[model samples]
Target chain A: MTTQASVAPLDRAPAPETPFFFPSGDRPLYAVHHAPVAGRANAPVVVHCHSLGVEQVTCYRAEVLCARAAAAAGFPVLRYHARGHGDSAGDFADATLARLIEDALAAAREALRRSGATHVIWLGVRFGALVAASALPLGPPAAGLALWEPVQSPRDYFRAQLRGLLYSQVAEGRKPTETVDDLFARLDRDGAVDVHGYYLHRALADSVRDVTLARRLETWNGPTFLAQIEQRRSLAPAHAALAEALAARGAKVETMRVPEEPGWHMVANPAWTSPELVAATAEWLRAVA
Target chain B: MPWRESAADLDRARAERPIVVPSAFGGLVGIYTPAAPDVPSAGLCAVLLTRPRSHRNRMWVEGARRLAAQGFACFRFDYHGTGDSEGPTGPLDPNRPYRDDIVTVLRVLRAQLGGRRFVLCGACFDARTALSAFADEADAIAGLMFMAAPVVELDTLVRVDADRKDWGHLARSLRNPYNWKSLASAGRWRYMATVIGRVARRSLGAAPAGDPPLGAAFVEHFQALLRSRARALFLYGRDDAEYESFRIAERTAFAKLTPEQRARLEVEVWDGTVHGFLEMKRQRETFERALGWIAALHPARAAAPARTIPGDATPSAVAG
Candidate 1:
């Protein structure tokens, strides 16, 4: 048996990634910083806001790959878990959309401070894109925005999530005893509903339901990259409209439709990657930088 | 006692530290939650493994926190090529455990945590990995907590896939005369024929070729675990197909165990629980049961009382 006082030293050198906890109010948000590769400086630091629930798990690998790619291309990248998510301190049941936005802004500031960069770019995947966009007018000025399959309508997203809960119930061989309306009622009565292991809180549900990205995002005209990740070739109508709206407000908008699996929900491959998505985003980052 | 601390102090009690341990692939990213200082340390560390497709956050982050609160230092990490860990991702075989990555984590824990016996916990594919790791590092492991582990390797996956693809649809279709006609189509007929053939072979007391009895390796590892000093708790949802398969396959082996080995092993099948325990209610039940089992392992060292989840009755014990 080993003694409590004897600590063994690490045999290997430190990895390029640095994981730490930064404060978001009294609670701490977990974050990992990937330093820009050798001698690169003054490039806009990238702060990543991840999606909520299972989508976060599904897109985790892709997010890591994208962050590493950006870091290799001379941009310092910071990937963080919003409060009440991942290793962060808080219960998922208490997490609100507003709180998530606050966490994103905090991450952006921390990334800029750590990298000593003049500005920051927000990179968000799925619902995270909505968060990044939501934080735009509320924060430290962003140099650019990169959204991968952003959720344009929160109401539709919540409905889909509720449908997913029902689907899971049926998939587990249990006859779903409640309808979508009944679930909403339960959410109202209990203030939260379990949606495939994640707690969908009423506050979050209400806030998300009220958000219409195109109408709500009225300020800040920065360079933006919109990636429509799906099997089909065309940009989603809602996304195309959001891109047009951003352009209308003097933001330089570039949209790419990557023909790939929408990894935010269901993924067939565990090590799934979208090289095209990464490559295009990197190019966009370089251009904006 | 640490459990009597103020809300603020209790909130500050748990500190999640992120660590990167070097592996063959590169670095494996993990979060380590040390046992609360105010609590009596069990001198044991729990290593939580991630399911193949899911990240560590699935149900593990909260689990680690809960364990840490109960005086067990806990670590949960992403396997190389998954989550934030660096490596080239490739197709993973369900039968093949990620032994190398698991061993790497174990070594790091032994080095960093020091002087602590480890409890290996995992679910589904990861449960198999934990069992394999326990068999390989028996001396270092004090206990094993497995949820819905496959007694017969790859069998659960096959059943889950079949359930998703055919069983439900087939059962529903069989009730309708019109659907029976559609089921007689070439593709459907081929699938049904294969199933019937397998059933016929089983009835004739002939095992399928290439399908070893009770998964030879799993049985070997399990027997090794039983012979060791380490204790184990196996929890399964009654509805999970693996539950029935495990009960049928491991019956003889479990029956032949010595009283001492049986005393150290436990098996529980809960009512209305699914394979993943995806619902919060079921997850809480699992965590409470697991925590209770862990606490019972070393009662003198346990710092807090095992929390009882409401509405969870006594689980039906299949063994021990």
Candidate 2:
């Protein structure tokens, strides 16, 4: 079943939830394409890939809202889970670089087939950014890229995430019931590494460690934009350094600053959203990608 | 004092070749060092040590002192563009001759530390870049010591590779609800900002292009790094979630190494270390293991060529 996507044309209905089954003959990817109930066909496509962890569940509402906004803007938006999350087919343990890459390629193929649009605009949050960066380059390139807190270094990220978890839990007077090693070992044994209660698979974690999108971007040689927000300025030094490095290589960058709630990483607090960052990325993409 | 002992503290020491054996890569090799420039003689060695690896002010002699006291010279020198070296000072820009820096760092280490009996050591991702230097010349190194080497095979290592996703926007949105659309349009100077961001990524990206591996280290190379030499030591926190993220498979791989290969391998699991090995008392254990390594090498040192080994020679003169 070498199902390379060749989507059938359909009229864009207002607020339609288009059910899609994307198969690469390897794994079937389930997706729900969103469009305004009364939109015209050939609308701009927003391929929204979600984050990993409990946030994937918590922030799902926000993703829906973003998709709705894009749909209302005479643009069709689509969001899909990587093999293991939401209603996707495979187990999270199956999340590997190769599989995710295949899933991303299939998603892009389906996006092109459904929208009648030739180019795509990738909207990735967290791990999704890596997928889009890796997959988009395998084809005719994307129009633009909008990434939100894409995992920068899986090692540092997981470390920060774990430290954040410990701090928050400790602040709340939580005791270390089990050694952190046990938790990681449990994850490895079970194939799903748990981060702040979100169970992620071994393969997915491997994919994260293996996928280097900054290098991937260097290869893309197309319109690219990385929106970095300075909340507590935690990422300022690192991302700023990264920004400078990227700039020298020739990629559009938009940096935005906003107040941070210190414990955003500690606990998944959905209270902060930098409007400036969102605007900067949107505008950057409009101009470049 | 032959070299005007610049490191005021290491004025008294001597050089010793603790071990000389056939390198795993089919080459003859051994750890060598100079007698302490300042002290000149004192088998105690710790009080009279003098080899510094970085360009200058960026001296990484601390790792050696801390580890050597327990008994081995762990070379934590900074290569080009890092630490004290005048090479690449900017943000790991990736484009600025990193390979040259890699070559220079190793070449300098070889010139300075190889003849004096020193083991090559790396911390975190530094191991990856350092190993890449020897990827072609693995046979020349006396031995490799990776203190807290990242598990490049784990998925977490790839985060740096994802590029500048609008994390700021995500952070902003998570912090508060602010309409991001009209803002960029209203601001007349956005294009320049966008252009700058793009350029920075491109520049950083370019550095890693010729780099053997970018962002994350894979299982294959990581294993090679483990087996690159017969005397390879990997120290990491087994319990640290973040460290364990990628190390999960690597730890497993470490066990699969042969006994002879494994003899060359030492895996020290810090009960509770962050990615940086920030545990309270693990430093003591780490130092002890290093001392044990030095002791183990004593037998090998007896088998190597004997010279009128001056107890005063520091690591600098003998290493070269």
Weakest lDDT window of 10 consecutive positions for candidate 1 chain A: A1-10
What's the CA error at residue A160 for candidate 1, in Å? 1.3
- The two-chain DockQ for each candidate, comma-separated, is 0.27, 0.01
TM-score of 1: 0.85
Q: What is the TM-score of chain B in candidate 1?
A: 0.77
- Clash pairs (backbone) in predicted model 1: none
Lowest lDDT 10-mer window, candidate 2 chain B?
B47-56
Provide the RMSD of all predictions against the true structure, rounded to 1 decimal: 7.6, 25.8
Residue B77 Cα positional deviation in candidate 1, in Å, after optimal superposition: 1.2
Query: How well is each residue in A127-198 modelled by candidate 1, as lDDT tens digits?
Result: 898898888777676789898888888778787788877765565446789998898899889887777656
Docking class of 2: incorrect
lDDT, candidate 2, A1-289, per-residue tens: 0112222112122365554456654455556677544444544577876665444543343454455445544566777756655434444545576777677777877877787767788877766777777777784347666776666666566556665655544543456565556655665687654454344466666566654556666654444555543357445565566556666767655554444332332212222333344434444443452
